[model samples]
Each structure stands twice: as C-alpha cells, then as structure tokens.
Target: MAKGDDLDPKGLIEESYKIEGISTAECRSIFLDWALSYQGVSAVGIAALLARHGLGTDHHPMTITLREGLLAPHAPKRRGGRRGRVVD
Candidate 1:
C-alpha cells in the first residue's frame, strides 16, 4: 500500500517521538485510532507497512497493539432464535 493510503497519513508515529512528554497510554490510544481508521486493510498488511515506517518494532506500543488486533478474532453475532423460527 502507498504511504498516503496508510492509516497514519500525518506521520503521527514519528511525530509522537518528538513530543516532550508523551505517555504509553497516549500512544496506545493513538495507535488504536490509527488501526481502526483502516478497516479495509488487513492487519498483516498494516503491520508490515508500519514496520517499514519504523513503528512496527516490539519496543513500540503501536506494534504490540497492531499484533494483538491482528490476532484477535471477530465475535460471532447472536441470533435471537433457536435454530430457525418464524417471526409471524
């Protein structure tokens, strides 16, 4: 994927390092926002792109979050009836 198409178009990861007192919690929040922004993309692809940009290392919270997001399975939706039931 192109850099412009990345979840972090503004390079927030790089910019975060420059901030004087950025906390891990804040970074985690930012990472979540970035990850959620690109629902159309796969977690693997996103992680790879982030790694290339230097934000996908184990040392970073962003990377950890990305990995967790990738591994987490989607929850199955619950239907209201047992097997099949007519609404009428």
Candidate 2:
C-alpha cells in the first residue's frame, strides 16, 4: 500500500500536473487510466493524493478531475439500454 505505487502507480496524475496549459479532456483521459490502473483505492487515499499534488491550484485540470472523481458515485451507473433500464 505504498503511496507512490498504490495511489498513482503509472505517475499519470503527477505528470498531468506538470504539463503546462493541460486541458480538462486530457486530464480526464489520464485520470481514467490512473483509476483503471489502481482500482479499489479509497476516497481517503484519493484525498491524500489530491492534497499532496493539488496544493494551491484550484483551477489545475488534474485537481479538478481528482475532485470530480471523489464526488462521483461509488456504485456503477446503469447505461441506457432496454435490459439496463428495465427494473427488476
């Protein structure tokens, strides 16, 4: 459960912050990769990473993405399809 390896094993989040004028879309793509790479990381862990990496830049794309990820629902949302939309 090391911070560096566990939270952001690929260092995508860290690198995204380093890119000057990075776009929200790019951050989102990097975030998705980070999330899929390190599944099951708790919200608290994410908060720590945010605190460490997101320091004073509220407008930072990575910071915004991380905050959004935190706010996102834990349960997977059902997609739009007859089978998916049908209530059991």
Q: What is the TM-score of each candidate against the true structure?
A: 0.50, 0.72
lDDT of each: 0.61, 0.81
What are the per-residue Cα lDDT tens digits for candidate 2 across 1-88? 2235667887777778779999999999988877777766558667977988988988998899889989968897677889887878
lDDT of 2 at 21: 94
What lDDT score is found at residue 57 in candidate 1? 50
Model number with the top TM-score: 2
Report lDDT (Cα) of residue 24, candidate 2: 97
Q: How accurate is candidate 1 locally (lDDT)?
A: 0.61
Off by over 4 Å in 1: 1-7, 17-21, 53-56, 74-88
